[model samples]
Structures are given as structure tokens and as C-alpha cells.
Target chain A: MAVLQILEYPDPILKQLSKEVTNFNSSLETFLKDFIETLNSHKYCVGLAAPQTGNLQRIIGIDISRARKPHLNNGLLILINPKILEVSDFKIVREGCLSIPDFTANVKRAMHIVVAYQNAKGEAKILSTKDFEAHAIQHEIDHLDGVLFLDKISNPASDLFRRVRY
Target chain B: MNESKNYFAVFVLGTDSPGIVADISKALFELGANINDSSHTIIGNQFAMLLLISTEPVYNTETIQNAFQIVTQKRGLTVYTHQLRHEDVYRKSSEPGQLCVIHLYGADKPGIVYQVTSLLAKNSVNITDLSTRRFGSESKPIYIMYLEAEVPNNIDTRKLGSDLNKLALSLNVEIKYELEEVASL
Candidate 1:
């Protein structure tokens, strides 16, 4: 397993839509291991997407259990070509990203979501999540679509805040 | 000239009028003064502005003040300029804490701001930004206050909420507090 460098904002790769992960083989497994390793390298980072590491594939890693308040999390999650089937219970919450450091903004997201994805073994899996887990999943999915939290801010003047260094 | 000693805080206040920003900005631009940060807003019939500016050491507070003399005379504006201390040139970074917003509204009354802010200050809660607005008719005005603060993690927000509830009841107002959840991804 290797920890890959996370691409920061203004990187053209981050703005490109990730392609679907069609070949689920040893290469995919190796990439997944590196993805998990990269995520674990950061403190309090709950989720990550393939595009964040310059990989143009629809792969995301999420483990909200690492979050400060892991409300309704299901340990580690590896999703390939993930899609949101249903969503409800919308709420506005502040969000920050590794790609865009030192800034946080309020973004509206679904509190509950039903999603379908493929596992590392190429088997199809579906899950319904709520609260923090759901929020993390949604954020990672946005990365696959070349979207960032800054694009989702409702009011730039008031909702955006400068994050304090830890 | 000491390039490091060229920072100043400028304040401008005047009746609301067109071209105020354009005129002021043009004057500063001609003087090669860079506006590092500025906030301008209209309150009722008055336009208020606060600016942090930096220029070449050759330009002092008096130099910048003289540049605005034309606008001051033409627009009848009040202007103040003060050289900033080295320490004051940069804002202190905020401490790591949970960000929260407190919203309060009720019939207009005296001591509302004093009472609420005093309680917050006593509890060690740092107020980051706050604004109050008066609405409705003059005979029956309503006061609404929105405040953003950094709350220490050690403090129980539920307890703070309860205390605010009690304060609201005593003051005949409504108070709501919510933590600004920051999702890390």
C-alpha cells in the first residue's frame, strides 16, 4: 500500500470528470489499497475520491468512523462507479476539503441517501446511510463529478469561513 | 524609506451618494496605496467604510490623508487615518474551536446587545462577527441579532442553549443556537 499525493485546488485534473471503473482486477485492488493508505495518512480525514489523487476513475473511499463525531457510520467503505439512487432530508452544513485547504463553507446536502456501487471484488452493492456518513459519501461523490464544496455554497459572503489551523 | 513601515487603517463616513467608492478608490490608486482589506456598507442614510491600506514608505498617514482632501471637500465626508503598529498589521489567527451561530430576535428594547454579549463574554465565548437590525414600525420595532462565535469544545453547548433559553425568557425574546458542522472530506 502506498500513500498518494492529494491534488490541491486549481489542479486541472481535479476539475475533470472521473471515468467509470470498468476493469475490476488486481490493478483496481492495488489502487484501492493506496487510496485507503492515503486517507489514513491524514488526521480526521473521513473520505477521499480517486480524482483527488489524480486518478480519473469513479472510485471513492469513506470511513466516517475516523471522524470526530462518527454518527451512524459503517466503518470503511470502498465504492467504485457509485451512484446516488435516492436522497431526502436535506440540511445545510459547513464542509471542508483536503483539495481546498484553510477554507470552509456552508453547503446544503441530503441528510439521508440511498446509493449503489461496486465493491473492490466487482460485485454490485447498495447501501442507505444517514447523517455524517451520508454527508461524507455525498462529498466524495461530488469529487467524482468534478464539483467542490465551494461550488455548492448558497451565500458566499456569509456562508464561507476561514478554517483555523489545527 | 522603510518599506516595512507603510501600513495604515483608514475610516470613512459620509452621506450615501453615488461615486463615493469610485472616487475614494481612484484617489488611493493614484497614490499607489494598496487596499489590503476593506469593508463598506450602507446604514440608513450613511455610508460607512473601514479600510486597511499599505503603501510605499515614502507615503505616510499625512500623505494619504492629503490625497483624500478633494473628495472630503466635495462630498463632505469624514475621514480618519492612523498608522498601524507592526503587530496590528496582521490579524491574529483564531484558535481552534467549534464555530457556532446564535440568532436572537424580539421586540426592540435597550440592553439586549449588552445582556447577551455580556453573558457570552463571561462564558469565555469569543464573538467573531455580530450584526443587529431594527425592523417594523418605529412604534413597534423588532430587533434581530445574528452572531457568529467560536465555542470551546470543553463547554457543553446544551447547557449554553439552556442558559440562553432562560435569558430569552427573561428578556421576552427568542434565541436559537446551532453548531456549524464542518465536514472533512
Candidate 2:
């Protein structure tokens, strides 16, 4: 069991573009497991990326099960070398990143998204997500491309400060 | 510059214009005042500004209260100043759960905003953000109200939408629910 340290923003590692995982072997398997463990170790965190833990690879881990939330039905979805095929109508979302650590941004995302990627078994697969789940997938994908949620926000007037309410 | 000194909370309300923000900031700035944080908005014809500013209290609330009040009255703005305590500096814990915005617009009449907000109150929905205004003329008035609310987890969006749809028919108003992403800092 490996719990990787989350790298915060302004760290050059977080800005690095993640490379595609060409070889899905045993080493990749260990990385995926460690990513999931690290994600679960944090409080109220539902998703994580390879770059989040200082790895510059196109690997993302997601799990949206919330103990406090009732309507959410989400689980771990690992995407390696993922690509967004199409996006539905644009919808704005409030999102905070593990990379940025403190500030949250009003990110605009597609209501529905179709993504093509490789699964854990190295088999190519495609999936479609809508609403909150779609927003999550896009967020992780942005990390793989070195794009943070702050980059996607439209208006700074709506930007917020003070991480903790004071 | 009174960079490290006492903090004061000032409440100003009246007709809003471009110079209102600049004038107040200019006065405070020249007096070596540092604005810690502030949030103000214009609703209808009135602009309300609440500022948390810090400056060396030359004499507590009575110090600049008279001078600023005179200036405020001359500018046609109502002003109330207070010496901020430690308790007043921090905001209390806000309501939990997701914040959503509901917008309603249609023919204006009695009991539109009242009936809509009353239904929300009945459902234990708290409106954290609200801005309402009337457009058009006396003969054909149009009412528009935008409300940001905190919705508990137990409620389903589909049911809420359906209920709102039913209410729209009875009230003769159009309503839309936009799940505002409030968690975004």
C-alpha cells in the first residue's frame, strides 16, 4: 500500500504535461493502485491524477462516493491516454483542484462528454458521462494536458479568495 | 500609513454611481487605511457597499465618525461606522450543501416573488443570494428575480423541477433551476 504525497500548485511538476502510457505493464499496475490509495487517504476527495503525485503520465483515478451526499452514485474510473471525443452543452461548474490546493474556480464544462481511453487491462474503451460525472472526467483530463480549472474559468469577478471562511 | 492598527466596518447605502466606490476608497486610502476585504452590490437603483477597512483609530468610533458622516451626507450617501471587534472580523459558518440559483420571470403581479420564495421557505430552502428587479412599464410590468439557495441532499432535482413546473402554471410565471457551483472559490 502506497500513499503518495499530493503536490500542490506552483510546483513545476503540476504544470508538466503528462505523457501517454504506451506500455501498460506491471509497473503501471502498481502506479494505478498507489494512485487509488492516495486518493482514498484524503478527506472529501473524489478524484486524483498521476501528475498530482509528481508523476507526469496520462493516468487519472476517480471515485465519487460521498458519505455525506445521498444523490451521488460515483466510483473509481481509471483513464490512461484518454482523449475527449465530444462534449455536450456547456455548463459552468464550481471546482477546486488538489494541485491548486486553496482557490476554487468557476469552470465551464460540457454537460455530457464522450471519452476514448485505455482501461487497466490495456484494452481501448470508450464511455459517456453526463452532469457532475462529466465535469469530473473533464477536470482529470485537463490535468493530463497541463490545464488547470483556473484556466477554464470565464470571469474573474466571480473568483473567490480565503480558502477557509474567516 | 496606519498599516498595522485597528479595523473598522463601514456601512454605506444610497444611489450607486461610478464615483461612489472610488470616492470612498480615495478617502480611506489618503487616510492610510487598508481595506482588508469588502463586498458591495447594486440592486435596482440603490447601491449598497459594506467595507471592512483598517486604520489607526485616532479616537475609536468617535474619531473619524463625525468627519466621515459629514462627507457622507454631502455626497448623498447614508453611512454608519463601527469599530470592528475580533468576533466581527470572521464570518460565521455558512449553510452547508450545494448552492443553486433559481430564476423566475414573467408577467408582473402581486404575490409572485412572495409566492415563489414562500414555497422555498416551506421546503426549508434558504436563499443566500437574491436580486430582484422590475422592468417595462406600469401598464405591462415584467418581474425578474434571481435567487441563489442552499438545497439539502435529500431533495431530488427531478421532483423539484416538476414541483416548480406545477407552481409555474398556477402562478403564470416561468422558472428555471441552475445548480450554481458555489464551492468554486
Give the TM-score of each candidate: 0.89, 0.76
Q: What is the C-alpha DockQ of each candidate?
A: 0.54, 0.29
| lDDT per residue (tens digit) for residues A1-166 in model 1 | 7899999999989888999988988898888889999999998899999999999999999988887654678999999999999999999887889999867888888999999999998899999999888988999999999999878886655777767767
Model 2 regions lying over 4 Å from their true place:
A8-16, A22-28, A65-74, A99-105, A120-123, A156-166, B1-9, B14-17, B27-37, B44-46, B53-76, B82-95, B154-167, B178-185
**What's the residue-level lDDT of B82 in candidate 1?**
95
Question: Candidate 2 on B14-57: residue-level lDDT in tens?
Answer: 98777888888877777777788787888778988888887775
What docking grade does candidate 1 earn? Answer: medium
**Tens-digit per-residue lDDT, A26-52, candidate 2:** 999888888888988876676788998
In Å, residue A23's CA in model 2 sits off its true spot by: 5.6
lDDT of 1 by residue, B22-62 (tens): 99999999999898778888999999998989998887888
Where does the lowest 10-residue lDDT sum fall in candidate 1 chain B?
B88-97
Instruction: Give the DockQ-based CAPRI class for model 2.
Output: acceptable
